[model samples]
Target: MADRSGNNKKKVNQGATLKKVFERLGKYRIFLIFSILLATVSVALTLYIPKLTGHAVDFIVSRGNVDFPGVLRVMVQIGICTLVTALAQWLMNVCNNKMTYQIVRDIRNEAFHKIEILPLKYIDGHAYGEVVSRVIADVDQFSDGLLMGFTQLFTGVATILGTFCFMLSVNVKITVVVVLITPLSFFVANFIAKRTFSMFKIQSETRGEQTGLIDEMIGNQKVVQVFGRGEDVTERFDEINERLNRASLRATFFSSITNPSTRFINSLVYTGVGITGAFAVVRGSLTVGQLSSFLSYANQYTKPFNEISGVVTEFQNAIACAQRVFELIEEEPQIPEPEQAVVLKDIDGNVKIEDVSFSYVPEQKLIEDFNLDVKPGQKIAIVGPTGCGKTTLINLLMRFYDVTGGQIKVENIDIREVTRKSLRAGYGMVLQDTWLKTGTIRENITMGRPDATEEEIIEAAKASHIHSYISRLPKGYDTWITEDGGGLSQGQKQLLCIARVMLCRPPMLILDEATSSIDTRTELKIQQAFAKLMEGRTTFIVAHRLSTIREADVILVMKDGKVIEQGNHESLLEQGGFYRHLYESQFAH
Candidate 1:
């Protein structure tokens, strides 16, 4: 029973691996067709060579002399066959390269598109380096396998079939001697391939882990330096590297053995065919020309077999890569866009959260039966201790994640019923961590609406209180920023983000700890800008500092995942609830 189960599992794995390879190839049907045509021509040329040589030998012997005309004719025919094979080989390579490039391009584009729509939850668990490897390394392997392996496979099979038929026509008895060795060679090659495939899979996985570690170290270099944990990181990386090295060595060792072993088998077959053909000629069952032709066919047959073994080994490595890519592509997205969704138009931003419940995981709920209603143009503040689901609330409201239970509505319609693009377009957000792309200040602010006029962009910058700071720079708004805006202070970046949001002019706005990193002077200016920006828009503020939320029309004090108190600043203080305690603790300082 155990043996049967293992066999069944192996069969299933093989089927899945083959399916993945075919699916990737299906994207390049035109290239595949051209490859087949080239292979056919090449195989036809290969098969014709033996027949032409046999005719030349028979003619020389029958004439009982060295006939110069016949010899010249035979040499010319052989040359023509060689030229045709060379041309076919070249065409096959061109088609193979083109197909591989196109397939890799499509895989990369699809992976990138998928990554764009993936939720923050999916990204949190994966390293940037690992994601990059999936796009580059894994996809490249799939392409290499499909192009090189498939080409060799088709050409090898054709060569074998063509050679076998011609050999049989010359002498059936000697043909059997040559053909008998093939099944044994095939079995040995397959066994080696299976072992090599196991090692390659391990190597691929270890490489991905190593890549992930490298990415983490680079991303947190600052933290490592501050904590003096560089030695620890090095040791950890060394461990992963050692494992990868061992796996790679094993894969190489197994794969390397395949080619030499196949060559040795071919050599043995060559000797056997020569000996057998000699005996047949001596017995008067075969002519000298027939024996020569049989020998040529034998060499042709074994050459492709030898080449096929190497290609098959490469194919197995490609299969390993395909497995990783297919796994990523098959993962179910955390949040899916709705079908037949309505596009939100002219949003008035009347936000309502009706008894919403949410959790990053099933066992640990982050928000439970949370309810709130905000009128258009109202300013609501959410104040809570750290990890009390403040950020999660914003993520849910933005549809970055779906609520576990209940509904969130905007403009009296359930958020899930609206297209994600239209839903997100109604709100402007400034996150706690300001991320700036590599571009100028003007480019960053105008990113939300590329079609906005120059005057409109400048006006938005002024509204965010950042126009004067940008004007002070030598290049003004055209001054380029480094990746992550390395030249700017945190406050400057935050102000830039505020300007970006202002340019969009959404009906609803969210400010998540927008002033936490700014100095007091900049904070005051930014607060004034926020006040002006929130005048006629529905705004949700998540503030750690109590002073910032003092002017809020409503304050919701939360603990764990539930709202414990809800009222205006003075009203909540009079009630002497959680809000009052939070206010005294934060503001009394």
Candidate 2:
């Protein structure tokens, strides 16, 4: 059974969505008005041409007096009218294209900026390629459809209305028939449009999913090749690609049939009008000139009905894409900034977390009543089994997420009291999963501090033990890395990230499994440098390897989001609790 309620909701949204599209264009309403006026005049001129031709025919042949002057005069007027009509139509199209692109550009920019402000949770929940498709592919489709829709809209209306009024003045009886059949075009267009709108929406969504799959498979191509699971990946992609293909085909099939179906109905109306007017001419109720003009007006009247059906079909597709674009634009942004926020400044880096609680979802608490305190410069290690909220703790500290309960303070001020940018600026971070954009090595290192001198950059690199590797490269620091730092080993990428942190030289630091990718020898070589980096700064190290945190002044043993133990390595070993068991498991082997 058809979903009556669903259909009703869709109908309501359809009206609202198209209204939104025009509202965006309404920013340039003056241009739209000029385009409409030009289109109306163009259609009027074209409609009047047939009447002049019929007059010339009557003057030359029907009167049997070869009035060449009258015929030539009518011909000249028709010639001038057609030329002017064509020119006006050209200018109208130019305006339509301009308006279509300007609106699309604004919409694209809005969607992109929205992505930047959106919360990390929102981005994490959706696939990257899916978001990109809406920004790029969907926006492009909306623009193309609007260009066609706007170009045809005014001309279609003016042609239909002008032809009807002219035909009515000529013969009301035939004009009545034309009016009665116009509903056929509307009914057909509306029916197909309603049916196709849902299909187009599904198609847009499926295309995004398919794009996401390709992005995922290609991004992990190395893993796929090592496991030799290319066929499996391709099979999964094929399933999504096939679904997209079916949805697109259905949307296109339904919309494609509208124009021809409307045309068939329009042809029937034209035939009936021609036959009735012929009989009227023979009976002397209409003159031959007027009968000829009625035939042409019959065609003109039906043409817009046909064009309107096609434009409606295209506009329906555009509306589907526009709805998706608007959804992203309208989504609530991340946590709102405080109206009277303080900027974190010149910090000694004393940190305190008291009764802090957090949860990814409301029902299942991830971290509950967590607390920690650190002096201005202290080395702290966070160790736990996987999924024990170590990463979650770092995320909360960075303000990527906010604590659900309690407060985290930096230098006695609640972190929430300060601007996120300035609060984050107090810390430098290096993670296991390295991020290096497509740029030269020097550029990547200096990304955190763009104004650092070359010597300072090299010093940071040497501190990370990556300077020797850079010196050996073909272009040293000037060599370009591909997307995601392709062509570099994982260890090299991590070293570059460390170099980035060294240059940042923030008052606080977080190293989350930061050296996991580097070899033991290389890591040992940088141990002193790491110590130096930690000097005079509050630091947090999250590590699975117990060897790295032996010298930490305080070691936090986390289990299920709560700190289960806190002490120096020797004290934790003496306690023989969870932390001792974990440390022994690694070194005892």
Best by TM-score: 2
Positional deviation of residue 222's Cα in model 1 after best superposition, in angstroms:
1.4
Q: Which predicted model would earn the best lDDT?
A: 2
Off by over 4 Å in 2: 62-65, 472-474
lDDT of 1 by residue, 1-589 (tens): 9988866875576679787657777888888898888998899897898788887787775545777798789889999999999999899988888887877787778778888877778787788888878878878777877777767887998898889888888888778888888776788789998777767878888888888888888877989999999999999999999999999999988888888888888888889899999998899998888888888889998998788888888887887877777667666665665688889998877989999999988998789999999999999899999999898899999998899899999989999988999989888999999988887878888888999998999998888778998899999999999757777888889889989998898889999998888889878888888888899899999999989988999888889999989989899999998888877887675
Give TM per candidate. Answer: 0.93, 0.96
lDDT of each: 0.86, 0.90
- The digit string of per-residue lDDT tens for model 2 on 107-170 reads 9999999999998998999999899999998998899888888888789999988998889888
